[model samples]
Target: MERKYFDCLIQAIDLINDGIHIVDRSGKIVYYNAAAKRLDEIDVDKAIGRHILEVYPSLTFDTSTLIKVLNTGNPIFNIEQNFINYKGDKISTINSTLPIIYNNKIVGAMEVSRNITEVRVLSEKIINLQRELYETNNTSVEKIKKPKAHYTFIDIIGQSKEMLKLKTLGLKAAMSDSPVMVCGNTGTGKELFVQSIHNSSNRKNKPFIAQNCAALPSNLLESILFGSVKGSFTGAENRPGLFELANNGTLFLDEINSMPLELQAKLLRVLQDGRIRRVGSSNTIDVDVRIISAINIDLNEVIESKQLRQDLFYRLNVITLIIPDLSKRKEDISILIDYFIKKYNDKCKKFFNGVSKEVLDIFMDYSWPGNVRELEHAIESAISLYDGDIIREEHLPFQFKNFHPTKNFTLDTNVIQPLNTAVEKVEKEIITSALEQTDYNISKAAKIINVPRQTLQYKIKKLDIPFK
Candidate 1:
């Protein structure tokens, strides 16, 4: 190479993030880039012309790949090495060394190294997480009790007829070892119900693991649900999946509809045979795990969309429990509001009277698309902001204001009736309007009319309202 071109090449090499070093056949330093100086914590002034052994006294012919490559006139690749740098800071690297030959004679050697300290640290963290998950499954601890169960049936708070019926069915399902599939809209406390069922089950003493299927990609979800062996993928390590970890316990897979269709077929096989094959292993392991899966969308819709397999749906839907959305159980709103108020009052160290009538009216009127979780957040935010005795309309979230039901009643100009009869007619029209707007969902209609669900149901029956 020409001298100017050689300088340009060196400048290009200096721009690389990896450490680069070159030495003559005898191991005297010939070229070192800025990355090499930074990685080694070396002073460029002292290192430029120094012998390799003089600069790094810790490296010997036996320990240094550059020396070995020069002696043998052969190339070495991807050898991990650790040693103290120029500043005595511990350095770790994955290194590659190659001998430079000219005219069939060794003239020099070049070395490229990449820092892997952070990578190794991250690998160790993953190993620890996997290890903890495995230990919780395999070893029984006599002294240190397992991590406390997060939730139980008693923790589920609801009083609406639909909620009560679901809870009763949930408790029944908990007693059996059959697979349970929970269906509910997002934020309607599906996970809460799953956790409660796990705690109330015969396998309560065993591990209870919950994973959201939608949280990961298909390949990763497969590896997480079914254990993986080393070399399964590029950097995979041998690890047990949730199926093995939840053996003799409960495995709750949330948003199961989000899982890939192909994986759903494999899951069906597991459900059928109670056997799981790891990602890279041929052997099948028997797992006595009670599977409880949840989905926010309707199963029929999921099947039609091909998001879930028909065979898999049948296998999991053995003990299907459909949890009604918050709008379908408006009677529970007051009880839930009180529960949340007390919870936040204790958490924030504030004692405020319950929500004002206007605030409650707005809350009842607003359709909670985010369901219980949204309601809880709204109450928490109001409690945090309000310093007064009661949560007022101002404390309510902005969405509530936008969702408040209109009270305007438009009468037909062609119709004329007696005063009492007209009053009843207008009342029936308002009731019918509320029901229609809420899709005949009585709980939502009650909230819209600022009445309890039971009261709305009674009025619907008494007025002979034409609703489906």
Candidate 2:
């Protein structure tokens, strides 16, 4: 039965996509799975029972993670390693090596490796091509045309006091060369503010490059941001990172909280002295770029969770600008709606004067979790579906249907009531509709209306609404 179990485990390990290699404490290869054979381009019969150094001549005792684990009885995880196999071919892999202990004694070590040679090669090629294009364009033209920032302060649409204050602060931040941090919820046009800052800054004529930190993995993102030297890793070529490309202008890093902590330390060094070293190179290059980073969530929460390094945050947060959510700035709803309507009308070539009273009331009452972007999309969708002179509740998106006003309150302009009474009535109606739609499930109802569950519960009690 023990032999059967061992065979079953071996079969499972052999079928996996990652290479598995096990070595005894003496460093003899005991098990080399099929994936290991393919990744190293070695024959199974030649690898098994041979010393690790004999199988891969390029690996030394100090350089091999597997051998280190065996000697130290410590584990090493997710480390990128580049080495030459017995076939004299360069290989790159992310390897995690673990020590196998039996009866409180280290018996063997096993390594699981995911091949990333192709991915590394392809990414390097892309960087090289981009560098070639940049150099060609710059040298070919007498008047070099740098990347432009399309938006300016005037393009920002808002009249609310909060927005006005934010814009004023943004303009001030633009004047300084300090690293600025923009905080706002998703879809609040963080990029718009970023571009506006760059266009208004002293380095406006230089390149303005933007990269979302969450868009790529740690390894790829590191290479793309810091660049790589030829032979740094297998298939790596000379290439410049975003820092070099945006040397004289701005490097806008969106979702900065998503960057890896190790990389953040590297970034902190750059921010400290304006110097950066490409991957696998000892040479340091000076950069004159200003960094403008943006995060979608609360600052304190990410710092507490350790998703972002506090030291790096402090360096980048020298000039912090927090944009208010749409719900907090309700006064701008009508203005934003009108702007979106006119803007879409010109684009769609449809004449949409404005939304009807019922639609307007619903728009004002609904919680826009997606913020201004959502409102614009809702208007555009309504315009596309209906070719009427004015948009009505029926023309709006399906989400707005849950916010239809109750019959007790008339939406007519002639009907007047106290503001508090009218607001309470509308809130009750919308909450009740969300509850019914979610079958009395408070969590689901809150999610449908895009409010916190606790807030929904408080509203339920305040409004005296019944639920199962």
Candidate 3:
């Protein structure tokens, strides 16, 4: 080629954004474009005599294939790998190389490449989305539109007659498309029923999200259950809420009785309308989310007293389920004890064959105010302490160690414990169990308990539970 034509070609090469490299059949650098040279900080004018690998050590790879391409006088496409340039910035690229054949003999390999860093990044994002889709299906956590309960029907480990009845109802509820109201005392695993309903539902393929209606402030809760548009409020990121996110799925609203009257009305509207508008926007986005609500408080009182809207109560009570307290389900204690033993055996790296009969007797006799969740934590704690496969009474936490099954056998006496003492006991149980489960992260503990950071801090102070 003439010098003028070569200069014109160089100008054309300079216009390309992606790197380009040209190597002669002798494996020496012949024509590396401005972009390609920029990638390696190599001056093409001074690079004419050097071998491709000698110039860029990072570009050196399986050369047998390249040699084959050259020897066969053919083109190769999409040679893929990670590339670290002269500046040490990692880049991903796909190289398409063609042998610039002359008189049927390969003279050089002209390689064109596109930086696939963004493409790879986009591909990773797609993989994450797919994982989120599949992982949500596989995890032990209940599928929900909110952040209420982590457990589902399977996670509720018990074989008592009462538990079996609850399970039957839960499975039947899961098969139905109607709204389900789960009633239980605080920490009684009402949310578990909600999750079981969702996991077993027809829409299990979609997301299962949950939220505590009474947890967030009315405005924040409204925005969370519905959604808020961009510029809806100061510093708002314009995110969609549970209703839109749970479309084609289930939404578990925990502590439903605690929901404010105004939001209860809004919820009733969504239940009837099947559509949600952003907090400050008028555009109504339709949704198809099943409702599975749980309440620690009595809904009858809530509705009768007008604390909760009567109309909303009637609407949501299409298929109501009253979860029996742990005290009433003594039949399932041994099964649950063994289940948690097996669970924490792997988690705590301890070989716990099973709970001692002594431990099982105490567990069966104890009136669990906190229900299945409390038992799970108790067993987890026992596993952490007990070195042997058999979980003895000594391996149990301090409270359980001194806990006499006959101490609070009466419901009247059990229901009247001092709030401060009760809080301390619950806090100790939750903290010790959380540590045993996560090896102790205060942040994770706070998250599991679903308390505010400051609230958790206060609880830690009040309980005198050291967070290590």
Model 1 agreement with the true structure over 1-468: per-residue lDDT tens digits: 899999998889999999999999789998888998888778778787788888887677787878889998889876666566656665657789999989999999999998865654454355456447545444565422464258877788898788888889999999999889999888888887888888888787777777778734455667778877876543456878878877888888888988877788888889889999998799999999889999999867988898888888888889988988787888889999999999999999888779888778767766777999999999899888878779887887766643445467877768877888777788798888777656677877787668988888887788888878
The digit string of per-residue lDDT tens for model 3 on 1-468 reads 999999998899888988887788887887778887766676888777777667655554454334446667777765554455566666656567788888977888877877656654443344344335433455567553333235568787777777778888889988889999898887677766787777777877677776766633465566667767765543234666777767777888877878877778888887898888888798999988888888787766777677667888889889989888777878777777777777888788887788777777777765565778888888887777658768788877665655543322223455888877766676677666655444465665565556777887786777787777
Taking every candidate in turn, the Cα RMSD to the unseen true structure, in Å, is: 13.6, 5.5, 20.0
Going through the candidates in the order shown, the clash numbers are: 0, 0, 13
lDDT of each residue in 1-468, candidate 2, tens digit only: 699999999899989999999999899999999999999988889899999998877777877889999989999987777788866777878889999999989999999999987876766566565455444454466324654689998988999999999899999999999999999999898989999999999888777878888734576678888998987765466789988878888999999999978889989899898899998899999999999999999988878989899889888999998888887888999999889999999999999898888888877766677899999999999888789899988887776665544335445558888888788888898888777655577886797677999999999999898777
Using TM-score as the measure, name the better of candidate 2 and candidate 3.
Answer: 2
Highest-scoring model, lDDT: 2
Which pairs clash (backbone N, Cα, C closer than 3 Å) in model 2?
none
TM-score of each: 0.63, 0.77, 0.54
Ten consecutive residues with minimal summed lDDT in candidate 1?
A: 140-149
Greater TM-score among 1 and 3 belongs to: 1
Reference-based lDDT, each prediction:
0.80, 0.85, 0.71
